[model samples]
Target: MKKLNMISMSLFLLAFLGCRSNDNIEYQANLDNAVRKIHSDLQKELNTDVPSLSVYIVSPKGTYFSTVNGANGDLMTRKTYFRFASNTKNFTSAAILKMMQDGWLNLDDKITAHIPGTSISYVPETSDWNFKYKDQITIRELLQHNAGIYDVTNDDSAYHINGQTYTDYMLENFPDHQFSATDYVKVLSQNNLTYGPPNTVYHYSNTGFSILSEIIARVYSQKSNASKTYGNYMYDHIVGPSSKTPLNIKFPELASDKQLPIPYIKGFIKYADHNEITNQKNASAHIGEGNGIGSMEMLSVYIRSLMKAENVLTASSIQQMRTSKGPATTSNYALGCTYVPGVGYGHNGATEGYLSTMLYDPETDFSVIVVLPFWDLRNMNNFEKCLTTLNVTAMEAKKALEY
Candidate 1:
């Protein structure tokens, strides 16, 4: 429950995998086949609409599947790319956990204790950013999004200022902030937030996670010989090992840098007054540890790895990541992921042009990844239905294991 809850504290994604039973070869094989077919069906539906899809699937036992290429013999893997978005939170939490295990920083340690330049503050009245938390916004709180941190980008929602990417924005602004957690404090001070009594409630705050990232940077990246944990650390710790997906959820360390399979599949709505741009995609860099870019195969691999985690932390940690932090905001949120009925853990990425859902069920040893290059506000529940169907898919795959 602790690890699953930790997942809730991080960013939110929807998907997870259950433990792999090596003895159930037949079951695993059926799931793989179903995965391929699922992608096949998706491709057929999307062919006339989108550019290409590099479909992939992974099992609980390190066994993997990818269908970047369609079985119709026309499409070939298409470079195996998709934006992971907020799923990157899994990696962020894992990195912090690694730091904890390394004995570098305690999860209970006050972030202010280690982060040099960073100072915490919140708004009390209306349009200010002065008050920092009095106390109790511990490492665990930040990881769990209970730190009472609030967003401060784009009038607090602008993650990236300007046409500026994360790099451009950070380089221009964070230069003095470099190698210093105090720098994070300074950046934090720039925002208007308010703190509640510590741990009394669960509020999702990217600011808290960002602070955690800065703290990790201070301890492991700056203080240690490694210099930075970044995306590779996520692969080493969780993504590659826990889930069927192996894409580095943290950094572009594993990224090919080739022409990324454009995440958004631009399309037009017949009725909408404006030309509806669809399939907008951004890399994990967009969300950083909160939300990174990834593909279906990588996500699947990650879930399966959780079912068979050897990377670090106990299986209990993984379980905690899947548990609910409390009640969700009309959405079922576990630690790093969301929840669906019968499906233990899942997450959805809601951005401009992309829509994604990854669902996992431990009881069934089942997982499913669903992505659409389009965002239809009219049928937002489309994915909810898809989530339920995906759980059923997982159950069917589990049944095959019995066969």
Candidate 2:
């Protein structure tokens, strides 16, 4: 009787395990189909001349990637590298937090305060330009975009030297110019371009991030007594340590380093009459803000590790980075990350030729990265359609994970 009972119990356990495994398989299949549908729908709706569109989703169930090549016939694969642009902000934020964790700096430290054991200010004091509220802005304010710094890249007013906006003036006149953080600050001061007092408003300023990069370099240099660029510190400390496998992501030290790795997705700038290949444009002008280059797979892995607190930053620090401050009008931006309602905490990137979206839902441990290889900067209708597709892809990915 005992032997018969044991056999029956073993059969029951096997059936239960088999049913669970089948359920998981069904869920994964449904997710893959949903991702495929998203890619198909995007191609049909956009109807634009783009080199490629790719979506990568990582979930507990499995990983799903879908891509569609356009008329250019440049195939975009998981290994194909692309410029991540402003997604580098998240990395910058994480590096700052890591430094904080190491007791090198504090979030509330004033930017004008002298570096520990050094007379140099957190931001180098300069007679070249005057910075408003330089003494009042804290590290936290910059991280949260509450510093009210004038955004030379996106601000519309005259940049004093020319009738055109700063971005237009620079791109047309100095497309290959290598700009430093101090140069950006000088432009802001000379133009008297400011949003208002620090901690009073929320304006997305790439210039503020450039300042943060400077602070990172200064703080590390003063603390360690070793000269290191922001990119070097990041590679050696943050990005390098987090990855279990080698990642190809890199912060280009020079504006002339425009060529991406082999098997890279080409980017295009669409005009009314024709498309221009912009894969070789200088990224130095947007350093520390929008100048990261790497593959989608590497980005996915990095972000997942970041959100999971796995070999990157502590879970508490990650939570702090995701916590939004200031008024409700701040656009749900937290530190260097953005909260996309149901999508998760991540950052988006847009340059002249590429638009990318990244989101990681901590609740579900799901991450979605979508990259489109073309951007129509002048055409609002086309740009809006592209943005809409990215948002939809994220929502669908979240829904698929739930399923």
Candidate 3:
């Protein structure tokens, strides 16, 4: 996923060029030319076969423009659903922040306080059992990726250093494996290792967010006295609340028989090789890690609503979500959202076959959403470049509209 901050120097340059005003005929012509150029160049430049790309930009005044390009089946429609991947973290974090705003919990609450036994919850003692600082892990630390909790998903590259990754282990050992967030935490807590002691460095951990999902579910369950899954909680409270009528965004359940959500585009394990893999069975594995699925249009609208702080969250909560918990100089990450100094706030997520991003700038009320097949995990540079190009395209249009 392209998680890097996207600062739109193009918008500044366009302004420097003294572009025509938004209502002027020349401005409209410039906008059309810019969009056409962006689309054409992307068609030629993105290094992928059977590419499925969706880009949507919404301006402050509520006007929007969007396009879908690529060869993957069904991806051309706004109704086709795609995996949000780690972008799910933004939903997770928003939900948690909302819960905090509603007085359900505080950011500083210790994880063990809500999910008892988590501090001592370890697996086999021989291979992993050291919870020296486990009790100190807090909700804030986890949100900030400073919890020092061992990440099960992409921990130290030495495969199985702690244990097999959730995806690899389940795919090979038990193809029918169903994920239980609670169970995952129980097992992961056992491998008592920290990237460094808490609050030391920013080590992205899907594992930490998974644990947060479990906490969110547990907290909601306590209040309602009804079963609440993490995915359901986010849809009901976070995404759904922000959605406008007819733009409903829902969490997709893996069909009982393990089929991709109908009307979904084909995603690949390898974009270059087109190594397509079936993923419905694994969709439920980690709701927090990235499983919030929806159509590109629905996602775009829903995210714009989020940025506007509609009915979904309080102003204070939204501000909290956008405030960085890291070092003073860097705006790399806020609570659930990532940030660029003068760009926007959001996150990018990539699972095995999908790549997605959502960014919104409250100042300009501008938002950009990109969902596309992630062809190569090793090609971070290219991915970032592709995303930057899209950002420039979107911002340039926003500039035109702003006039």
Candidate 4:
């Protein structure tokens, strides 16, 4: 369960065959066939289940194709906003990398050097093993999921309801609970546990990204000398400055009245049971981990701008962001982005109801973003599970269009 929900969307493409660069008549014919297959696959889902889709693919030249599949609700268009999940990590890391480029912080700087109230701040002299390595963790380690930090979302006692996991509990009980990013980090610190020693291995933890968000907040707070937040910095700097168009992506506050933009698709839980949890109260708890909302068109623009090295980061900074540090694991993840060996760089995001993927190959300048409908938690729960195949389908489309 730990690895399943948070797994990179590119997992199935690990064994993907060689790229086909031939853009001939035969290649075009094959590409058409592949698109037909994908469209048909999505049609099956729209016919029986979810009612929203916003898929946009771009090639090296420019806009390749954009389509709005399924039935669009009266208010829901392909432009409807939805959660970006762990893909939010990309934005957070990009912001931190930008800060590093601006001489505000360095990747190797100790996490405690920035965020003072971390577990590293409270080093208790006891036999408890989980509390030992807090002081040794670095900012780079957290970005790479090698911080050895405890996962509050999955591992914390506070996240457990009765015996079931919090996500499962949410599916069943529909509880209205909200927690701050500090609450999550505090749970990790107080629990005195970690995946492993810092920089020794890789373990994906949303808690680590939440810590990054807090670190970003602290950095911005110090620089501005005011009570600013990570969300404000993201809008004012990250998304706002980079885009050539007006993009509306923001980190929602945990305040009870806060709500996602309307006209969005409702995400489901169990497909067979037909359970729904759209716009739940606590969807915006941890800012950096997986709590971003935006439309697919704007998100694609943000990614393309980054790939073209337009305004997000300098060429050198982009290289720094792409360079892989030690203790690498699956997906060959750098600070925030995932690599496809010699192919491309991208990431995937999944929460309770929404699943999204974004991949861009700099070599060919091909980018694909897939926001699959209603997540199926259990592998055997649904016959036509789209999340399992969305990444591969998007990749196939990329390869086809490139050829």
Give the candidate number with the greatest TM-score: 2
Q: What lDDT does the true structure give each of the candidates? A: 0.48, 0.80, 0.64, 0.66
Report each candidate's C-alpha RMSD, comma-separated, in the order given: 12.4, 2.9, 9.8, 11.8
When 2 and 4 are scored with lDDT, the better candidate is 2
Q: Please write out the lDDT profile of model 1 over residues 266-299, one tens digit for every residue.
A: 3222123443542332332233433455566656
TM-score of 2: 0.90
Report the lDDT of model 1 for residue 270.
Answer: 17
Sorting all predicted structures by TM-score, with the top scorer first, yields 2, 4, 3, 1
Cα lDDT tens digits for candidate 2, 316-399: 998888885755235889889988888888998987788888888988888889888787655788677776777777787667
Alpha-carbon deviation at 93 in model 3, angstroms: 1.5
- Which candidate number has the best lDDT? 2
Off by over 4 Å in 1: 1-79, 115-131, 153-188, 235-273, 276-291, 324-334, 377-403
- Which is superior by TM-score, 2 or 4? 2
- Give TM-scores for every candidate, taking all chains together and pairing residue i with residue i: 0.59, 0.90, 0.77, 0.78
